[model samples]
Target chain A: MRAFVLATAAAAIALGAATTPAQAGATLDAVKARGEVVCGVNTSLYGFSYPDDKGVWRGLDVDTCRAVAAALFGNAQKARFVPLSAQARFTALQSGEIDMLPRNTTWTLTRDTANGLNFAPTTYYDGQGFLVAKKLGVKSAKELSGATVCVQTGTTTELNLADYFRANKLDLKPVTIEKYEEVTAAYLAGRCDALTSDISQLASIRANDTPNPADHVILPEVISKEPLAPAVRHGDDQWYDIVVWSIFATMQGEEFGLTSANVDQALNSSDPNIKRFLGVTPGLGAALGVDEKWAYNIIKQVGNYGEIFDRNVGKDSKLQMARGLNAEWTKGGLMYSPPFR
Target chain B: MPTVRWYNNRRVRGVLYQIIVLGGVVALAAYLVDNTLHNLERRSIATGFDFLGREAGFGISETLIDYSPADTYFHALLVGLFNTLKVSIIGIVLATVLGTIAGIARLSRNWLVAQFATFYVETLRNIPVLLQLFFWYALITEALPVPREALNPLPGVFLSARGMRFPEPVWGATHVAMLVALIVGIVAAVILARWARRRQERTGQIFPTGASATALILGLPAIAYIAGGAPTALDMPELRGFNFTGGVVVTPEFAALLIGLVLYTGTFIAEIVRGGILAVSHGQTEAGLALGLSRGLVTRLIVLPQALRVIIPPLTSQYLNLTKNSSLAVAIGFPDLVSVANTAINQTGQAVEGVAIIMAVYLTISLSISAFMNWYNQRIALKGGR
Candidate 1:
């Protein structure tokens, strides 16, 4: 009798779960009704997502979240930034604890297909690289044979380090640490010969280093490809499109020379592409269940990609990162957008 | 008649209630599983444990076992588990020794000694472990001088920003003999201890057990060293062009993690030790003194035994806490078990399976620790029930 009851209950639950729709439409509708988008970001990555003195989250990744909010609600301020660590970020996205993840998370095949998450578009083109003290007089990564490399444990940096060393047939010893700060510390402490991570991270680290940032040099060797993109949970094509187009709008704004300062002037222009982009022409916003002026709103409210990058990580900022691969496609870089039409 | 009936029926009702509660719990668990599977299906996310067999193209930073980007997800996870065990075991041993010393020092007659121990415990206990890890890693490690300007504390010992490089010993036949001698010495010490205990019980006269045990352990090893012709030789680290060429290098990451764990856990252990000692009545010490026992003898004979009874239970808990807290190695990028599992999860996208494996590994560790501690506690427990 006990076995029969247990079996019946199990069967009933299975039946109920099977019938339930897994679409995130309800979640999307709820966010829309709430009139604010909850965006998860990194808690303390300098150029990526970190809080300013006023306690407002500011970074390239944070800007991406704001851009999405602007596209959705016509106001960039309509975002709740939830700081997350690398360990907790994915779970937060999956559990609907956050509306979107705009942290500087790498886009990999497994994440896109197997993790039930969708990467919107590549926002930053990154590659794995090593940073070593300049006083070592080692000109290249090839010289790092039998060297102890400090690497973060869970990141792609570790995998790339192994692959690079093995391919080079170098007897390298990697000392894995769990946090970015530890890796930096080990590298700085002279405990490891080199520190390995994303090239952009190396740039940020170098910029943040004391005394003289020029003392440490980032090696020119680019190992694995790391295409960082904003991500959302799968099963909502409408939400996916909304995010993808929002990013595309930023790139489009940059290409059309529509800065936040001059977005109003650009809106008054007679150009068809600019007119369509700013929603001077109607019907596009209806398609995405947003206002027709979504692109204009994103640009005017959140600024263009150039503005976002410069404000967060450009030469003027502490990170002082060169717009290498993140530059526009026409300027021999990877940043390109599909036609807004 | 009614009262008699109620009493007779009570046993049956108790069993019935238990069964109903058990059934309800089972039913709820079934419902949760069903809902999850249904949601997974509706979302078209494949739910199975087969993903463990997939190729994990990601590499780990530090692995005891051979692992590569070409390895399976299961292999990566296994490597991660091994790393976790490696750090936790090392951390556990170190923390215990540090804690015991600190705990004893806290109760020392010297004001400075007690104050220092107290300070260590208080400061470490207050700060977050992750922040401490960062402070050690970033501020301390990174600030070291370069290899060219490496600080050589002694011959064959090089300290630089890269890490501490010590001499790598080249072991041969003599080394093997030395090791054998050490094992023999340990055996001799154990036999001597048993003999001393028997002598004390029978004669009621104390043998200098400590002196005898020390002699047995050290004398045997010393004699073996001389007899074996001093086979071991130091192969000191050499500073070549830019860096230390050949030596056993201890990376800063491992150093920072070790230091942080020891310092943090040692504080709690000190407090436990102090409390345990204080719990032993002043009368016990006074009685030992009244019997004309020396201060050292009084402590060794009376206080420690009683204090340890109170100390052991809480001490065991501290050890377990330190072991678990070693997981914070992820925050500092130590390739401990959790960190390694995280990489595997990210690389394989088998979140469910990966997490399950991690939980299982930790659960096993926790259970083993508890079991060992319980056994020790039982063995040391006051026998004969007073």
Candidate 2:
């Protein structure tokens, strides 16, 4: 009798599991139906994605999500952020809990293929670097041999740290904590001699998390190339293109000298490139299966790439980080967009 | 063929129900497994345990075994297993001792001792283990001084946020010989104990088995050490570029985790121990005292022997709980089995296999502990009684 009851329960669970629709390339339709784009972001990264005092999400990554929302629904407020840790980010994307992941996730071959994720475009070009207390009198990464470094687990930083130390023939002990706050806390509490992370994150942590920002110095050596990009699950080409073009719109806006303030005035501009890019010519929006005013909505709502950077982690923010490798191609950097035509 | 309908027959009904249930369970399991595999394949996640043989290019903070970034994932996981065992075994032993002491004290005639045990139980058992872990981690890191100005509390022992560094004797042939001698001594001691017990059973004369066993074990190794010239070369840790260079360092992470697990599990074990002792009737203790036994002797000889039947089963669960709770070491950066497996999952993008490995490991450990405890309980159980 007990066996019968147990089997019935098991069959019920199987029925429920079978009812969950298998995911395919319907993310765009799902987003449209749901009226919101759920983007996974960093839990508490200062400039990449974090909540402000009013609990409003704001960062470069957050703006990317907003840009996607504006491109889709023509309303930036239609985007929502789900904060994720380094370990949970990819699983969230894979499980379809989040529509897109802009959580400072690195674009690697394993993630792009093995994890069943597709990278859109490089949003933030980062590299592994070290930050140490100034009192340590360390000027270069080479000086950090035998140093115990605090790092967040489940990131490229951990792998890069191991590779760098091995290649350099240095003895390094890493305190791999799961959370950003705990990792930094360990470093600040003298449990580690230094902290290893991307230079952008190091800058953010120094500017915001530390008691004395001046006490920490970022090392000069860049150990590994960390091309951080927004990701979407594979098998969704339409949704993938939407996210790609949304970010490219921001960069193209910057290329064409458009900002959130001046984008409205550009509606009347005669520049063919600007008009074509902004969907004044109707083919671009129709191609991505969005409204004709999609690019315009993004530029107006989330601003151009330069404006986004400056407002969040650049000179306008407390981080005061330089747009060293994120500048426009015309200015000798890597930010480039294909021709609108 | 029967007078009554087949459905009305109890045997027929039972067989039919069991078959239906079995079919349903099998079908459910097959569907779930098939669905999961299909999803995994569709998502491009590489399945199987192939990744275990791949290189693990990450470092663990405190490893019990030798590990480098160049090691295979299998080797790294072995290190992780060792680390888990290291903490769990030590935690179990220390928790048992602490619990037994506290349990006895809780029933003490002295007011202060009993109140103190009560205070320890209440404070530790009420708060969450994770919170206690965080508290201990923070306290260790925040309160300890930096390595350069490490507190020298004892000669050749330094306490700092980096770790507690102490000198260790350098390993040599003499140490090897001593280890062999110690093992031999233990075997000899056990044989002697059996012989003494048998002699006491046959003859009415008592034997000092405890003193004799202690002498045999320590004296054998001592003679071996002296004969081998007693080379006492110590490797003392020295302040190096960033940390201490040599000797053993008990990291703040490991220490905090151990302290938290022991204290948290100790409280429950203490309660279990107290309950077990209390469950033994007062009559047994009174009977022993009336027969001219001391209070300590009465509790040990009469009450505890019976209490074993009650204590051993619950104590098994406490052991399992401590082992499982050691997985919380990940939260504090102790790099136990779960922590290493998580890192592997993230690196390999093989979440399914990684999780499976963790489950298998913990299951094996818990089952082994349960089996041992059961055997011990059986040995102490009353013969020819329900």
Candidate 3:
């Protein structure tokens, strides 16, 4: 037993060490020199991160990685997307399989500290919600006392589902599976009474993946606060700052009323704040060890957060998700960016 | 003293070679641990079993033991281990029975029976077990109708996408007592068979042990059951909104996994049995027939016992394979040890500890099965202690 334990401990260390032989510090230098930033994203989420018919990755999370690449090399397409499962996302980032993971991963204290990860500011504030068939007439989760819920395993959504059921004294039969497709299939086939996941994911699956989109309705009850964000490995303060500020540039761009179509027009804006942000006067990017026009390149290449959200999952997309808690602080949402000066 | 040539110094060379290998192994192990620790520390990932006591907030689809979200991780692990065992134990027994039947049928005079056995083995063994598992899981989840329109194919048996629910005997003091009585009866039957065998060998008269043993086993349990108030009532399922309540349910995951395992492993076992039977000389059956022994008696008293010796070793491995292959339950979402530990690792960020726990569990299960098979093989060997 002792030998077994030691052997496994050795294996764990070997895996970790093997991934990083000589790489060190800031990750930005290596990424820039490599000319491509490997960013991990979900493989098959409808509106978050998924490939299109042309095999081009597009979605909110995919755009975040692109925004980071734009900040660094001034080319959004320089970011390469590696699709990862929920269980694989952390290890991939931790083991240096990917430089950044903008995979709709939730930011909790345990994930931020214990997982050796540093989450950027909230990219999309989601919440735990349920999607039940319309015929069930289950308006809220409270009425799901004897429900069989299909949930994706290796996720906090499973935990929240159990908590909700136990708290309500419900006798739940959970069908916990590995992937999103399995759970969705189970829900569609009536193997489960309802499907539980993030509200954003619920909307995405229902609108795009489901056979009959109108047959299922998301429940009114929001059980848990799921502030989803992009993440990078801890340490490398320079890289962490770059990833965080990359997100902030988008939030701050939206805050200053900037869009991809009009970003070049704002380059000549006489407004002092807009000038500082677009790097008409350069300070923020150089402070973070990047080009002066980093934010300008991001806005030019990837558009701001609102535009990304709108195009990927908002009214224009099949998901049709409203900008509920993901809007700007000025619009009564939680997206507050730090001063770029 | 005559000078010993270095080439002839076997002792020194052996010692030197052993030292080199040992040193290499130690260095490798040391490197692994050192690097792993450095990486874990660098990542701030926890690396111990301390999280085993923490609450496992996740829910398992099918649990043999009482489990709640408030249960500890250790408790959850135990539940998962038991679920894996439950499927494997049941799968092994059923696979053996199915395999043995198919094996015998493969040599039957009827062409259809022989052809069907061939078909069963060729079809099932060729497809990957994981694919078979997914196929069965999909059938249960997709092909089965909703709970509201559950197919009642048999009395008190309900089949739906929710699961296959059937009537089960409600346990009570009487049932417990009867169960003990049944065990006692089985033990008595074994002793009686041994005594009867010796008596028959010495006295030149058949003792009719089989009938007597069967009677004792069934009769004792029946009497105890009757004495304890004849509690033969079954708890039948009733439709509750979207599922059947108050019956023993084989969850679709469990059903899918069990059927998949039994069907897949049984094919290999069937082939093994066929080979074992064929290994027994054909002349042995011809000789028994020439001696004017009835065919039924010849087979019962002759072929099977000999075939068992050839069959047991490979059959044991098939059982172990089935148990270990049960980890594929993770792919389909049955909360086996691997799946539960994976979720724990994901939740706790204790990858090393979680993987170690899984490795230990599967090792224990495989080792235990191997030990039991070795013991059984010893008792049944054709030669003494061979």
Candidate 4:
């Protein structure tokens, strides 16, 4: 009996230990060796990461993944996507199941510090907002005192929903579903009075998920700051730098007046900053341990940040979201990149 | 050494083998722990149970206890555990009653009844429970109207996609006194039952224990109600802004999960009941009938007591399965243990600790159930042909 107990204790200890090594440059090395970048993304958020009718991933987050692949392998098609739930995203990144998470995840303080994640610059500056049916005669969030709200579990929105209700001293019943589709479905079915998520997500849901987009109104109140960004695991500075620059390359592409159509023309420009950023000069790529034309490949294949945004979620897309806070820094928005030098 | 070699000795060899196996297990466990610690340190992810003390800034749709966003993670987990227990306990009772009735009906002389029971068992048990949950959830949320246009089938009740809301009595001092009196009445009835049993054994005259016990239990609570001045104040649920407020609510999520669990687990239990009844020899029924007993009396006295021996052990497993399957509440947003823990894991980034808590809770619940069932099984077991 004593021997049996000892054996069981040892077995329990062994079973409890979960291990994943996150050495520097390990992710970049893995992505290069496999000739593809595996990105964890939303299962189906309309303009963030959702599969088109052709089963091809098409969204801003998906474009970010392709940009990474273009930077590393110089082929946008070399990027693969793993659809993850909000609950599963961070764990997937931490366990090295994906190279990085470009899912519509907010860059929160806890996630950055305690969750061992490194956030790139905000890809889309969003805010937590509410979407309610117009028939309810509710004009504002403050009128939703006794309302039941539908929210997605394991996202920053859930926390913010709770905080908003508590701060306002309102009685709230939040139906938090794990699946984004289910959360919206619950709201459309009238299981809840309103659905709460990021404003961009709410717009996507209103456009694509609802039966009548005109029936549901996105409330004017932005409850919390939700700077949705891409994330990579800690302990890999080189891999982190590569991911950071890949994202910046797209923004810098836009700043330099480069597009997929005219990027080749800009390659011949005499401007030193644009030349260094487009990898006309070799120092930028060597510093990040990629090919000299890394940024050029991202621009040629995935387009600049503005083009990716416009075609996916802005005027050219079904969502028709305006570039409010997501415009370039010179346009008085949060989208800015440091000098390439 | 020639007379008795340790290697040749059976007990010594057995002890040595066990030691070697234990040592290997311990060594493996140590290596894993060391590796895990080293990697965790490198990643800078916080470990340990301290996160349980932190505020859980999430909302649960249903809660049995007082909880808010200000509550700790531990409090949030308690609410989840209660929800799990509430569904499982109710599901077990309802499934047992339904299964036993169906099992008996399957053996009935009526062909229609037998066929229906057979169809139910064959159909429901074959399908997976998770899919059934989704089906029921979709049906409830899609078929029901919104709260503004709730289907009002009763005076103080409303049915909608949100849930079913009905009036409840205003809990007050009088209600508390009534509850206490009800408990006292139950104890008095039990004592009366014991007395009646002893009297029946002493003199072969049967007392009407059932009728008299029922009278005592109901009569005492009635007396307390009357003496407490009959405060008939009721908290009627009225449509207030978004939903029906000031009443007892049965959320659609809970209803769908319960219905799915009961229907799915009931089929397995019905089979167990049927098997238990069949295990009792036909000769026992014949003997009871030969002794001038009615069929119902024979079943109640002779067959059921013996059948219980066969019924209980498997029933225990079904109960455990029902409890564990309640964790599937996450699929339909029922906020059961796994759902709450999944959120905790995401928020705190403590996957290991969150998972450990869930495992510990389920293990404790499963073991407690097994222990109680074992005791009940032992009680019903035939004792040396006494």
Among all candidates shown, the one with the greatest TM-score: 2
lDDT of 1 by residue, A147-198 (tens): 7787765566767788788799876677765556656766776767788888
Categorize the docking of model 1.
acceptable
Clashes of each: 22, 0, 1, 0
Model 3 segments beyond 4 Å from truth? A1-23, B5-8, B384-386
Candidate 2 CAPRI-style tier: medium
A best-first ranking of the candidates according to their DockQ comes to: 2, 4, 3, 1
Writing each residue's lDDT as its tens digit, candidate 4 over B307-366 gives 999999999999999999999999889999999999999999988789989999999999
Q: Interface root mean square deviation of every model, in Å?
A: 4.6, 3.0, 6.3, 4.7
Candidate 1's displacement at residue A166, Å, is: 1.5
What DockQ results do all the predictions give, each relative to the true complex?
0.40, 0.59, 0.44, 0.49
Per-residue CA lDDT of model 2 for A82-187, tens digit only, reads 9998998888998889999999988999999888899988988999899999999999998888899999999989999999999999888999999888999999
- B1-386 in candidate 3: lDDT tens per residue? 88887645788767756765576577678777767877788777777788999999988877889998899999999999999999999999999999988988898899999999999999999999999999999998898889889999999999898888999999899888888989999999999999988988899788888899999899998998999999878999999776789878888888899999999999999999999999989899999899998998788778878888899999999999999999999878899988888888899888888888999888999999999999999888878555
- lDDT of every model, 2 decimals: 0.80, 0.92, 0.88, 0.91
**Per-residue lDDT over A1-341 for candidate 4, one digit per residue giving the tens place of the 0 to 100 score:** 45567666766656554333425558777887898999999999888898999999999999999998999889999989999999999989888999999998899889997898999888999999999999998888999998999999998999999999989999899998888888888888899999999999999999998888999999999999999899998888888888899999999889888999998999999999988988887798998888989999999999999999999999999999999999999998878989898
Candidate 3 CAPRI assessment class: acceptable
| Location of the lowest summed lDDT over 10 successive residues in candidate 4 chain B | B32-41
For model 2, residues B1-386, the per-residue Cα lDDT tens digits are 65986567889888888788678878877877778888888878889999999999999887777999999999999999999999999999999999999998999999999999999999999999999999999999999998899999888899999999999999989899999999999999999999988998899666888899999899998999999998889999899888887888899999999999999999999999999999998988888988998997787668988998999999999999999999998888999999999999999989989999999999999999999999999999998956
Q: Where does candidate 2 stray beyond 4 Å?
A: A1-21
